[model samples]
Structures are given as C-alpha cells and as structure tokens.
Target: MNVHIEVRRVNEAGEERTRTASIRDVARAADVSYQTVSRVLNDHPSIRPATKQRVLDAMEELRYRPNQAARALVTSRSSTLGVILGSRGEYGPTSSLAAFEDSAREHGYWVNSAYLRDTQPETIRAAVEHLRRQSVEGIVVHAPQVRVFDILAELDVDIPYLGLNTAERGIVELAEDQMRGGKMATEHLIELGHVEIVHVAGPQDWIEAESRMRGYLHALSDADLPTRAPILGDWTADFGYRAALELSHRLDFTAVFAANDAMAVGLMHGFRDVGIDVPRRVSIVGFDDIPLAAHSWPPLTTVHQQFAGLGRRAVTELLRLINADDAPPLLASVEPSLVVRASTARAFGHQ
Candidate 1:
C-alpha cells in the first residue's frame, strides 16, 4: 500500500505554517481555472451560479483573501473619485459637497475631498496633483471661481475631471441655470411693478456671480429698464449690510435684487435699521433661496437653485466619464424655480 501525507513548513520560531493561498490555489481546490476564480471574485455577471459557489467554497476552505492593492494595480482603477471644494461657509458649496457625497456613495465609489479658501491657480494644480498621486480614477472640481478654469486649462491630466457649478472647458460641467435664475428673480420683481431695481452682486471672481449678474442685466435690458453698475458684495451678510448703507444715501431704487439669499436677508436688516420697511417701502428679492431665506422675519421671495440636484448630476457625469473610454464631455444645467414668499409684494403703491 502507498500512502501520502501533506507536509507543512516550520520557521525559526518552530511554528508550522501552510503556504499562503492565492486565486490559483483556490481554483485548483475547486477544480476550476484561475480565470474562473478571478471572474467570481470580481462578481462578473457572466459567471455561472454553481461555479461561483464552488469557487467561494474553495476560498473559504483555503482561508484565502484577495489582495485588494494588487488587484487595483492590475486593473489600473482605484475605484475612488476626488472632490475639490471651497472652504467658504456658504450654502452653495456646502449643499453641493453633500450632494456629491450621496451620489458617489450610491455609485459604489469613494470620495476624497480637498478644501481651499481661495482658488489660486497654483493651489488648484496642487490639489489636482495630490488627488492624482492617490490614483483617484477621476476628479470632481467644485471650485466656482473662474481662476479655477484658468488653472485647470494649464494642467495636462489624463484622468477624467468634472466641474460642479462651473461651465464646461473640455470636461464635464454641471451647474444650475444661473442666467435663468437671475432672470426669474428680476422678472418676478418687475412684474410686481418695481421699475427701479438694484442688484447687489457677489464677488465677480466666481462664475455663478458673473452669470447671475449677466442674467440680471439681460432681464433689465429686455424689459427696457435702465441698468446700473452692480453694487459688489462678497456673498456675505456683512457685505450686504455695507452695501445697503451705501445705497441708503441715494435711496433711489424701489427694489433690490441681491445675488443670494444671505445678502437679501442682510439687506433687509440694514434697511430696517435705517427706518425702511421691507415690501412696504422697498421690496426685496434674492437668489439662491437658502434655508435662512424662509426663516427671515418675512419669508424671502427668491430663486431656488436646485443645488442638491446639481451636485448629484456632477458626480453622475464624473462617474460616466471615468467608466467610458471615449465619452464626450458634457455641460449639464439644472433648472431653477422662483419661490414666492413674504419678502416680495407689488411695489407699495402699484398694488
């Protein structure tokens, strides 16, 4: 009679150890090929159910675990996406980041985030480089500053990239219809019989602010109303306060269209401090109906940009680009709606 016994090896510590098992080991135990084990490990749909079960059972019996790092190297895909966002404490950026996170999670991708307070070209390049070093499959740039566009233009990254709240520049761009949003706010105020309107604009460096200012101008021109240079603000309540103080000296306009709801709320407070009543004296309208817009003394009538949807779409587009070999870059826009609230009413005497 002939008999065979499996022999294990012992190290200097005198502990017996079995050789580390691989997909080949599992396949041999399961009476399958290495390729079949690989397909099962990757959850390929074409694998037969029974075969997959046998491979899984073999892996269990051999106590085998896949080396994820080696697998990523072989596939050249890290299954991760990078997002660069502004550090500003504002509704637009904050809401967008949240939406991107939710969307990426649903798509089975992990998000790595980087925040910048000021969008300098060098800073953006550094962020992109950092994400690339991590081998993220793609990047989602949430910087709305035009400077970001300039910076991105200089980089020669082979990996796919997407922009959120910015226009397309040879890459996927997703944003709300800012021009429409601005027009909606202005037209609503105009319909309410406010002929003289002032726009308290945000920082000109941001594409959103610039687009909104254009829309405001377009609405005024279409209505044949006179246009004035926008009073620049920094998308901050404090800036709106100072702007309102400056405007109070002139007191020439019957209505104010602030770039965003924060400025609108601030303008209302500033007006109140100067003995001016909202809607009663000067009707106010704002863009980006942030949460605070509704909680104002009199709820704010403003344009609601679907920030969450924009964020979700940005991630979707980024993923699409990442998975495709020759996917055309796209520019997607989410529609914004006007929300009528107490902050606006027909010009005092027009009603």
Candidate 2:
C-alpha cells in the first residue's frame, strides 16, 4: 500500500495553504515507518547508512524541521539555559552575552537571561526563582559584585550555575586574567621610567576592580616603589574626569593606571582641560582595550580582555555540569596582552 499525505491548513486570508513540513511528512515522503523517522531524527546508531541518507534526503527536499520544544518535552531536556546578568549596559558584559547566546545556539541549545534591576537579597532570590520555574537546565551568573556571589551562595537552588569573571573560591568561574592585565598595565608605565604611578580604580566591591587594584599594588611592591592612595571610581568617564581634576592639585605622580579604557580616555580629556600634558606630564594606561580606545585623540595603551572567549567557555563549562559529565582537563585561562599606543610615552626629561 502506498499513501502520501500533503498537510493543508487555512490561512488568515481565507485561502488554503501548505503547512510547514513535519516529521510525519518526511516519513510519508521517504516511504518509511514513522518510528524509523524518529530514529533518524535522534541519530540512532542502528539505522543503516543507506536508510539514513534516504531519510536525510527526504527531509532536505521537504524542508522539514523537528520541533525542538516537542523533543525537549519527551526527553526531559528543555535545551534551554538561563543567565543572571547585571551591568547590562557595560561593554564587556554586553559583548559577552551576545557571544554566549551565539555559542549556545550553535550547540543546539537556547539561552534566557534574567537581568537584575536590583541586587538586593530578596530581589536576587526572586530572579533565581523565576529562572528556576522556566526549567532551564543551567544558569550563568554574570553579576560581578562580591555581594551578589554571597546572595547566590545562600540560595538553595539546585541548578548548576557558573559565574563569569568571578573568583575561584567555592565557585566555577571564567574570566580573562584581570590581575595579569592590571600588572601588565602598571609594568608598562614603570618600564617607561614612571615611578610615581597612581591608579584610578573601580568600585572596591567589584571582583575585577579588586583584582586590578591588587595587581597594581603588587607591581609597585616589586619595583620597591611606595603605594599611594588610589582614586576610587565608578568605572565611568565622568568619574575619570573628576579624578583627573583631583589629581591635578597633587602632582605627585607621573603616570596613571585607569582600571578600564573609558576612565582612561576621560582622564586624558580632564588633564587637557587642567593644562596637564599627557605623556609629557603624566602617562596613562588602562585595562580592557575597548574599540574606541584605538580611535581616541591619542590611541590608548591598554590590556585586551577576551570577553567573547570567556563567554564561550562559560557556556561550555555550564553545559558539562548540566549533563553530569566529568569535567574536562582544565584549559589555560585566556591571557590579556599589553597594547602599546601613543597614550603612553617615556617619562618626561628621561633620555
């Protein structure tokens, strides 16, 4: 017996239309049992190569797509992951989220994010519960605040979660080596004969800020240089501008290490306004070699963080945990490199 059915449905225009191809249609077109089609869809090993090829050809001809949601329902795998994201508008987090979703989709999974408007304990709990109810297999925590980590640790949520750009204490974390970047930035200035270096640091509570400040201090300690009070900032260009104004009154330093590029550029602008000639009077270096860093009035010297690579690895690690697979051999962390530019120069009056 031979039977091939063309599925038909009525459209909003009151006209008959051919619906999208389904697995049953593939089975009918391939002249195979529906169960055989299911086996092919799941890559069952028992299916002969000839039969597999035939099924595949039929599927390609019919433009058939298996319903991921339906497959998920049957296999108890939602094929979806969740992310708890903070600092959504920042360059690094924004770039990382896009790259993370791209990598997840390439692996046949979907990503959902719950942006934290407030990092309060109760608010964090509610966000966690919302994602939990969505049946996401795993979660990536992109909240960079130390307090957020404490909040997440207190929650009893059972889902496997990975923290991005976080510390390595009792948590699986992925990030470019920020301390290395910080040290590299400071060392660049030190090598240029700038002994009196100041650091424009981010908020103390941020993991990156803490690590960068530590690295800056370490570099000074190794050089037998005394540490000065760091100008704490909010990671904003405006803050950098203000810090530069403050530093103008105390011309004790020959160089400034701004924690990130945004602040560094603002510091340059602020110094110009205050008649402090950069490089000649004060050399500047920054972390996170953002795109605009290269195009600034004087191209910036900074450390480049691999934001995309970190995001990709975060998804990979989270998936392994979700699948209950043994952890892969630890790979080398992504190393940031120093990018020298006109923003840095040899110390003024140095030969």
Candidate 3:
C-alpha cells in the first residue's frame, strides 16, 4: 500500500501538482505483481535471476526507492553489519574499511562501524553492547590489538563476528602473510649485501609484528647471519625517529628494516638529520607500502600487502559463516611482494 496526499490550489498563477514514486507504481510500470516487486526489493533468493533483473530494470525506469522503516518491519533483519576497529585514522584500517563497505553494499547490506576511542576492556565492552542495541546481524572486528581478543572472549557473544587479522583457528580471519613479508624484507637487504641489518619492529603484542619478527629471525637463521634482537617500536613515525637516534650510539649495522613505511620514512628523516645518508651509509626497508611510500624522500623499499584483496576475502569468509554456506576450499596464503627502491644498495665493498 502507498499513501497519497492531495494538494489543492488555484489555477494558472499558483497551481499544485502531485509527485511520488511508490512500490505499487513500480509494480504497475514493471507489469508484475506487487508481491513480486516486494520480493525483488527484499532480494528474495527464490526469485529467478531473470525476473529479478527485469524487476530491477523496471524499478530504475520508474525511479523506485523503498521506504527503509517499512521494509525492515517486513523483513525482520537489520541488513546492517557492525565493524569494530581499533582506529579509523590509520592507513591500514581505513583501507580495509573501504573494501569491507564496498563488498557489503554489493551483497545488499549496510555497515555500522565503531572506531574505538579507547581500547580499555570496559570501553570495548560498551562498544559491543552499543552495536547489539542497533540489532546488527553480524560484526567485523578490525581491532588488531591482542587485548581485543581477550575482551571478546570475555563477552562471548553469540552473534557472528569476523576478524581482519588474527589467529583464531576455526573462525574467519584474514592476514597478509606477515612472516613471509618479514622474511622478504630481510632477504632483500641481505641480497643487497647488508651483513649487519638491525630491525626496528612494531610492539610485541601485535600479531603482525610478532609474525614479522619470526620471519626476520627465520631468514637470518637460514643465512647463518647473526640474530641481533630487534628494537621494539610503537608503529609510529615519532617512535621511528627516536629509535634511529638511539641507534646512533651503537651504530653497528649498515642497514635497518623498520616494520612499516611510516617508520621507515621517519628513520630516513632521522638519518638525514644526523648526516647518515640512506643506501650510501645505512640501507633501509619497511613494510605495508603505504600510498606515500613510493613518493618518500628515498622511495622506501618495502613489502606490499594486498589490503583490498584481504578485505574482500574477509567478507567472503564471513558471509560464508553468516549464511551457513559450505566452507570454501583452502586457499594459498596471501603473498607479500618486495618492492625494491632507492633506499637499499649493494654493500660498500661488494662492488
């Protein structure tokens, strides 16, 4: 049923006209039953694809848009997914969010994201409670901190949830092969003949950081190179700068591999300030080739993680569990690429 309002006015000088496009109007234009139009709008799986396409084409020709409140009342599902993320400002999370939203819309669902202002247990609990109130059908947890898992375990909510990057054995989780990525970064430096390569790695709690560190160690072990313990960092440029200055005192390694591009950029800045030219004196490499990495002062040589593909994969896996579909075949690990740039060069005496 559609509502119509009559607007009466004088003729000629001031006249009123009726204007509306309703579901019934769309059905009449499409020459289909009103129930068929409703089925198309609701994305009923039973409808034949040809019929659905025809209904969609007709709706477009008639300019049909459904009323949200009315539709939700009929469907009994929110058509919304909750996204719980650590931060919205970071390059990785934001990139993942874009892919997640795009994929959700393609599947006829909307997103409700919560960028945690605080990561405390109480704060995280509150955020989940908030999403529950919104009646979100599922959740996509983009929160990468180790503490996040702990909190979620405590809540143990029954709603379907997905993680962007974490090792949760049976659940849906997606992570760029951080270990392989780490090894690639380290191996690239070794190929450049940097014998003494130190690493400025992200904090120990992060799953990626730990995997990357393991890779670094594995590569060094394979090459019979010295295993110099990495200096832990906070995944920030400021920390990178400070770590570089601290390195000036020890100054044993001819190369450095920071865990992320931002830190690598900061390390370059720090090296420049102290007159230690990159590649000439100290070669450097980083990970997660952020948008600005290619344009950095020395053009950071880093590992490129396919975040867009990862996001899409996460959605696929999550939706599989959400819809109770058969599990997908085992897929190969996401390969991270080593992007060589001007930041690394052959060892001083290797020429």
Candidate 4:
C-alpha cells in the first residue's frame, strides 16, 4: 500500500506552508512500492541491494525521515538504550555516561538519558516509565544513591536493567571498587608517615561515599592508627574549601583524604587561604582522578578509576541481558589505582 505523508517546507518569503513527500512519493521517485520503502527502513533481508539503494536515494532526495515509533512497531526492536543518572555533574557519573553513549553508538544503538531530580520512589518510577514508553531494549542505571535501588526494586521494571554503582544481590551491578580506592588513598598517607589522617567524605547516603569511607576506616584499623571523625562533604570544591576553613583552626590531623578530586582541590585552596601549605603541612589525596586532578596546584595524589571502561562494560553486559544470551560469570568489581603526586608528602615530623 502507498501511504502519503505531507512534509512541510519554506519559501523565500519564509511563510509557513505545506509540502507532501509520502512513502508513495518515495516509491514513485525510486520506481518501487511503498512496502519496499518500509522494508528498506527496517533492513529486511529480502530487499535486494540495488532496490534498497534506490529507496535510500529516494529518501535522501525527498528529505524523508522515518518515524522511529512507526519503525519500531513494524520491527519490534527500538535499537535504543536508556540511562538513569542520580548525579549533579559529578565527574565519575558524567564521564561514565559519555563513554556509555559512545559505546552504545558503536553498537548501532541510540541512547536516552534521564536524571533524577530527587530520590523519591515516585521520581525513579517516572524516569523508568518515561524510558519504557520509548521501547528501549535495555536500561543502564548510574544512580549512586542507596535508596534509588531500593525504590527500583519496588517498581515493576520489566526490561533488562543494569546498575553501575551497586552491589545489591538481585541487581546486576557493575562498578569500580570504591572501598579499595578509599583504602588506597588513606594507605598512601599512612605510608608517607602520617598517622593523624582525617577523611573528607561525600554525602552519607551515597553508596560510593559509604564504600570509600569504609576503605579509609579499614586502612586505619589495619595500621592500628587512631581514627578521628570523618568530615562529611557534599562532593563539591566549595564544600572542601569550607571544610578546610573549619579544619584549619585545629591542630589534630596532618593529612586529609577526600572522597573526590573536586573536594580535594577545594581543600587545597582552603588550606592555602588559611596559610597552610598542602603536603608540607597537611597532605591531601582524592579519588576519581578527573582530568583536572593532575593539573591542580601542587598536583593531586588520587585514586584513578576506569570510569570509561566501566561504562563500555555496562553497555556490553546490558546488551547481553537484552539478547538473553548465555551469561558468563561477572567480574566482582573494577579495580582502581593510586596516582602519587605532589599533593601528598611525609607527615610533618617525618619530613
């Protein structure tokens, strides 16, 4: 059947008007039926290459764009992936998202993303529902909050879903070892002859924050070092600066380990403002080795997570779930590395 479509165009006067360029119009232009055009769009195996070329050429000539919804209805495949994020411009989540999109595109899939405005169950449900309506083949969740998963578990999510920062038993979680990274950061300071180490942590509810804090505590306990209370931060450089101002008045700790590079860099600024030299007075270390970590003043000693690798891995695993492939054993966690730099040094007396 020939289906006619009216496509709009503009004249030299820029007045609104109507133009028609239907599948039938494409068929006439290419000397084929509208059915052939539909088949071409769906990549039906039966269409000859030469005939497919004519339809494609006709589409190009007529500037006809196929409706994705219509195509999905015919093929029962949307070739789309959904990503749900619960970050406010944090480097790790943001970096991972970019890599995931690139990898999805490489696999000939389109990506749709939704950011959580809040962690309320209703918000998470809406985000999932919005993506599901698009007929996404799978969903990759990067929301790091503990409650996000709790809420997700409650939702009747029928599609294949993968989590990037969870270790829940039922959820397919893929993540770098945040605890190890935190331990690595703290241990580096301990190895530098620093005993009075303080932790600058992210929000209390975040999974990454909790994991890294555990690592810090574990390192301290292993060395039999006295533990002071960790200062909770909001994963912002500004918060680090403020925390620095508060800590500068004290003479207890000689080193600080931050949950993220942004806070680490801010801590450096705050210390500088208070006439405290980084590493020389208070050694600092951070996580996520963002691009600016090495470029920060005195350079930051931090943990390097393979965020991009994790993102690519997530896409691959999600696809496997979507395809119902014979799944292989999953990696326990992605390992993180420590990057030693000028920001950390031997504790005051040792130096």
Give per-model TM-scores: 0.84, 0.86, 0.82, 0.87
Error of 1 at 210 (Å): 0.1
Candidate 1's residue-wise lDDT over 53-142, tens digit each? 988888877778887667778778776789887655778888877888888889877788777767777777788888877778888777
What is the C-alpha RMSD, rounded to one decimal, of candidate 1?
4.9
Q: Which lDDT tens digits does candidate 2 get at residues 1-351?
A: 233456789988999998998888888888888889989988899999999988888888777888876876777788899999877788999988998899999998888889889789998998889887777889999887888878888886789887886764223333437777888899999899998999999987888898899889999999998898888899999999988998899898889999999999999999999999987888999888889999986888999888888778777888888888895647546678899999989887774
Residue-by-residue lDDT tens digits, candidate 3, 134-177: 77778888875777878888889777887777767223334538
Query: Clashes in model 4: which pairs?
Result: none
| Minimal lDDT window, size 10, model 4 | 167-176
Best candidate, TM-score? 4
Who wins the lDDT comparison? 4
Ranking by lDDT: 4, 2, 1, 3
- Model 3 scores worst on lDDT over the 10 consecutive residues at 1-10
| Alpha carbon lDDT of each predicted model | 0.81, 0.85, 0.80, 0.87
RMSD of each: 4.9, 3.3, 4.9, 4.1
Off by over 4 Å in 4: 1-20, 169-173, 327-334
